[model samples]
Target chain A: MKYSKQEYLDYVDKKSPDSPIWKNVLIAFLVGGAICTIGQGFSEFYKNVVGLSEENVKTAVPITMVFLGALFTGLDLYNKLAKHAGAGTLVPITGFANAIVSPAMEFKREGWVLGLAAKMFTIAGPVLVYGINSSIIVGLIYYLIQKL
Target chain B: MNKKLGKQTIRFANGINILSYASIAGQKEGEGPLAKYYDKVLEDAEWGEDTWEKTESKMQKSAVSRAVEKAEIDIKDIEYLFAGDLLNQCISSTFGLRDFGVPFLGVYGACSTMAETLGLASSMIDGGFANTAVAVTSSHFCTAERQYRFPLEYGGQRPPTAQWTVTGSGSMVLTRQGNGPYITHFTAGKIIDAGVADANNMGAAMAPAAADTLATHFRDTEKIPQDYDLILTGDLGKVGKSIAIDLLAEEGFDMSENYNDCGCMVFDIDKQDMHAGGSGCGCGAITLCGYIMDMFRAEKIKNLLFVGTGALLSPTSTMQGESIPCVAHAIAISAKGE
Candidate 1:
């Protein structure tokens, strides 16, 4: 009895257990909201206590968050948190910091140059590339519209 | 003296015995249900090594030494050694066993390496090519994770189908001489692709191959599932095991009884938070060497069918959207050589 590719896929899909989408969404929402709240707290601290300008406060908040992310990754706690948090940790700027620091730390055994520096951007490199290119295209369209 | 049985099965005319076996497990595995069965469980994943790859090599080294020591044979007496691991270029096996100075043959059947090595080693002994040989395989959780998935500290969620790779190693000493629990038949499996492209869902990718090999083994040996006291597949976990059972049932073989998977047995799935169950080359190797061997020695199981299953897909292949190609190899071991 031979099963075609589609038949086999359908059978596997039916047999295999699916992830709990509703539960995951709920967790991700709560945790992601909590992280954003923390970021807001940092923004308030920088603006009021530190007496920083609006733009500088925005920059300081993200830097602090990235720092916390890298520190947690180094302490080996972010992955543990992200395990249950799911997209909660990933949707934040902290996730980007983890994406960079993790490979760097993991491959550090190879060497400082080839291992840590070269592979640091493996995950986040694509995000940067596409993000910057898309922004430039948008800026060019805005400039053309203004000229017209 | 034709040893060929059916299309894929080989009947050993001369007795091929498992003289001794050993298992070394990691901390997580040590905390599992089969903890007491393992020869030694390391508290550290690194095993005092600088890297995870080195730790895996150390595990293979320890496993082989323990097996050889239990067999009461010197390393020099062993004519051939078969070993492998789930590392690129099989560096763990090569680096681990290099110091022994034995005739080494490195094999790669993905996670099915244990069965592949055993089948080859036993065949070598039965064919009079070697009087004594050893089969060993190892897999490290960290090493496998870094190579196959993401970095250790990378924050990502695994789906329900993802299996935790077992951090362990197992080795078996096979010789032409022993009293019982001899390898009677070997059935090599074909590469079966069931169009599963998800690397995380390894059980689904490998189930069809396992089912095909098991069915072929039964057909070639002309033995029913009732003939064996136990039928075990390597690292099918919960998902693949059920799929395999259903596939076999469709082919008129009822595997609802006497059929379990090493993946499910090696770890306490519910308690350990191992989504699907244990996987990797070590999953089958340790289960067979540690728990199942004790069962054999105690005469609890007279007949056993061990099938090692493997999903042959690399990260590159998965990235290319290619389906996983899987294989399974079955070896029939009987206490009375029946």
Candidate 2:
């Protein structure tokens, strides 16, 4: 119970779950590539079929992916797919949508206010707070430089 | 009047009889090898409750009432109830037995709650404070996850050192007289902290406490591991069990032959992929009240030592990067004179 630091580190290393490196890499590659292809398809559809400009197409694609991710999560389909897809389900913007929806759904039983609404930001909360705050700081710096 | 031995052991002159017991497990626990030991296994995790906390309360209530029923005693005759859970305010026990009409004593030893409750209940009976008492504890996977670590929906990766909290409740009745395993000795544990801060690795955090308690119990009683048919720890899982073995060996005691962990025994580690195996307040409680009781009834074991280990850390404390403080309480039960 009272092992040295090196022994403790060894114990952790030995107990660590074995991950099949090549197999995981293959799955990640195939899955991640497939998600990107779908995004490209959406962009093409918006540009050609809907006649959207490149700027609008860029905006529409991420919105569509996030919607689909939330819908899949609601249907309880994303987690199942994530099992096989691994990092594939997690690498895309849809994964970000899933990060919000999953915890929200899990806490729904605690009631809408304290449970779902409060927990909706469990995973994405930090990202949003830092991302927005840093952008505001950067905008200030840019304006100050222009004035100088 | 005093049975205290050395620093920890308490020998009950008029051994307390374990009247009866009951265990209730969730779907995942039911699927494990010890399914048959449980009195009831819920097919759904919610157990018809709106939240996991409510479900845990429901389980404790069921386990206690069924244990009393099995003892064939009138509900009004039960004098005291000792129960707890891995929840804030020990809400599971408070809300679960709100209608039992029995005087309640809420205790907390984290995963070691069962042993602590049993030790206290046995002392109460042996001290003539109560003729009949019940010890019950419950833990649910979902409830403990959100409370101790993270939201169930986080889908965070668990390391191999991590243990799955058993979603179950186990209850036992202790009476002054009965035909069951007799509580012969109880050894209280000292709070031991080895400065381990990682919450995920509970086995490591609790192992030193377990080793210290076991060594103290042995020294106080002037006995060794071989004296008992079995020596079981509450929920050390695979990793902590090995560490305990090494630590005991350092003290010139070898426990390889009879030592086992409730965590590893509750679930098939390889098959269930439970990593380091099960850990929770209910993990040891159910295994002892359910599996070990069945073994005792079958006369396969004459005596045993049960040490319930617990990592006493709250989410707030862990979030603030405080080290996990741990404890292990030991109880000696015998069937030799029965």
What DockQ does each candidate score versus the true complex, computed on alpha carbons?
0.85, 0.39
lDDT of 1 by residue, B61-89 (tens): 99999999999999999999999999999
Instruction: Enumerate residue pairs that collide in model 2.
Output: none
Question: Global CA lDDT of candidate 2, please?
Answer: 0.88
Residue-wise C-alpha lDDT for candidate 2, range B49-89, written one tens digit per residue: 88888999999999999999998888789899999999999
Q: What TM-score fits each model?
A: 0.99, 0.93
lDDT by candidate, in order shown: 0.94, 0.88
The most accurate candidate by DockQ is 1
